[model samples]
Every structure is written in C-alpha cells, then in structure tokens.
Target: MSDVGDCLFCKIIAGEIPSKKVYEDDSTYAFADIQPKAKVHVLIVPKRHYATVAELAQNDPAELSHIVGVAKSIADDAFHGAYRLVFNTGEDAGQSVFHVHAHVLTGEVLAE
Candidate 1:
C-alpha cells in the first residue's frame, strides 16, 4: 500500500497534483476520474488517507458517510440522483490507489 507521502490521491487532495475537481468540503474531495468509466465518473475521496474502505470504516465511519453524501450530491446534480457508488477495497478488488475512494458513476443508464 502507498503511504501518504507517495499516494496519488493524497497529492491530488493536497494540490500537489492537478485534478478536475467536482466537489470538496473539509473532509472530502471529489474529482473527475482520469479514465472515466461513465459519462459522469467522479471519484470521491476523504482528505485523510486510508488504505482501504474497511480501514476507513473501522477508523472513521462518519467520514465514509460524508463521502457517500458528497457522491449523492454529485450524482444528483449530474443525473437527477441516479447513480452507482462503487468501492474497490483492495488490490484484488481492483483498487489501484491505496487511498479509500468511492467511484460515483452516473449520467446514463448503468448495466446491472
């Protein structure tokens, strides 16, 4: 797992790396995915780095809830509240970045 010092999402949150920001608050940051999977594919992440969703949930569930709220807001604005929230927990689950994030997919009808 990548540490905060080398985490890509950490850099984006810290403004060390450029991102197409969609929404932000004291605890969360939402930005467009570099490789979008949907018409409106945004990644919502906590400002604090957590290796996985399990870790985040175990440590700070409120922040996880806040991230979901932010994702809902983004989806609501982008596609009338129809969206899919995805959390890839680990490397085997396709979580490329160690920092916990939610993939908000919306703006079109999604596959089941």
Candidate 2:
C-alpha cells in the first residue's frame, strides 16, 4: 500500500483523517466531503494514488472503474436517482487534492 504521507485522501483511507465514510472495499472508499457543495456530496477514491484523471494510466482502468462504480452506487443508494459525478483533472479544473477522486454531488442544481 502507498504511504499516507501528505495526501489527505490517503490519510482518510488509512484512518488518520476522520471522514463520514459511506462505502469501502478492498480497492476503493467513499466518504462525505468535509466541505460539501450540496445536500449530498460524497468523494470516491482509490486506495492507490493516481494524481489526476489526466494522469491515470490505461493499465489502471479496473481501479478507476471500481472508484467510479462505488461513486455511482452511493448516488443510487443515498441520493436516490439524482446525482452528478465529476472528476476534476487538474488545478485548472478545480482539483484541490492531487489524489484522483470522483465527486458525487446532488440535491441541488450545480453550476456548469
């Protein structure tokens, strides 16, 4: 496993940073956002580090699928048919954390 050094999501995955965990499996995890933008704001992250969507390797498709699948499941279960999945690729796209994550946002119309 990758060391949870300065990575916030890594810390969350390792039980260092406390989060309102929603879902977790061997390779992925989901939790509520510390700073929520909607009534339902969950972050789905992978156990391994992948800096951003643009940086994701083709070999990591399964891991990516697992993260996205978890996010979709959370949206289906918690939001109950209304949610949007967003992946910010880099700083220009509002990606604050380097670790790859899918934001499952719902309960309000988000500005495009």
Candidate 3:
C-alpha cells in the first residue's frame, strides 16, 4: 500500500507530533496511547503508512511480522508476560484512527 499523505501516525513517526514512544526502528514505532483504554495502553505503528490491518497484511508481510514482534516485546515488558493485544480493523470495529496499529492493552483483566 502507498503512504497516506496526511496520516497522523506517519506524522508521529516523523516526529511531527508528540508521542510517548516505547520502541522505534526503521520500519516501526511503538508508543503510549494519548487516551489509554487500559492501565497499559500502547499503540505499535509502522513508520510507513498503511490504512488498515488488511492492507498491511496483504502488502507487507515482513514489516507486519516485525511490527507484531515488537508489539509482543512491549506487551511482555508492560504486563510482565500477560496482556491482551488487539487490532481494530475498520470503522465498525472501533477504529477511529485510519493508521494501522496494534493495541497492547493490559494491567487489569478485561472480562472476555
């Protein structure tokens, strides 16, 4: 997928906006959520813009794997090896942000 010209996540990765970053590499970045939904809420995003998980999955397998791998490490550190990781796929799934990201949420168990 091609980059979105004005995606907020892209801007964040470019240091255009302030974010509490946890991890960063050439292809991905993980950061603390501005409005966290859990005691530990972090968003792991790709440095390159992809509008949705499907897009990322279809177009960039290597980058996607790296992104998830980094997210796992973040989750392990944040929750000490226990946490729930989520991806809001599209608008109907509560994906307010168009940027593709994985949500590592933990601290308190959210009843399934």
Q: Name the top TM-score candidate.
A: 1
| lDDT sort, best first | 1, 3, 2
List model 3 lDDT by residue over 18-68, tens digit each: 999889888889999999988988899988788888889999989888977
Compare the candidates by lDDT and give the number of the best one: 1
The residue pairs in collision within model 2 are: none
Q: Model 3, residue 29: what's the lDDT?
A: 90
1-112 in candidate 2: lDDT tens per residue?
Answer: 2244888899889999789988988888889998998888989888888888655546588788777677767777765666888898778888888988899997666677
- TM-score for each predicted model, relative to the true structure: 0.97, 0.85, 0.89
Alpha-carbon local distance difference test for all models:
0.93, 0.81, 0.84
**Candidate 3 segments exceeding 4 Å error:** 1-3
> Model 3 compared with the native: what TM-score?
0.89
Predicted structure 2, TM vs. truth: 0.85
Worst 10 residues of 3 by lDDT: 1-10
Q: What is the lDDT of residue 99 in candidate 2?
A: 88
Please write out the lDDT profile of model 1 over residues 1-112, one tens digit for every residue: 9978999999999999999999988889999999999999999999999999999999999999888888889889999999999999888899999999999999999989
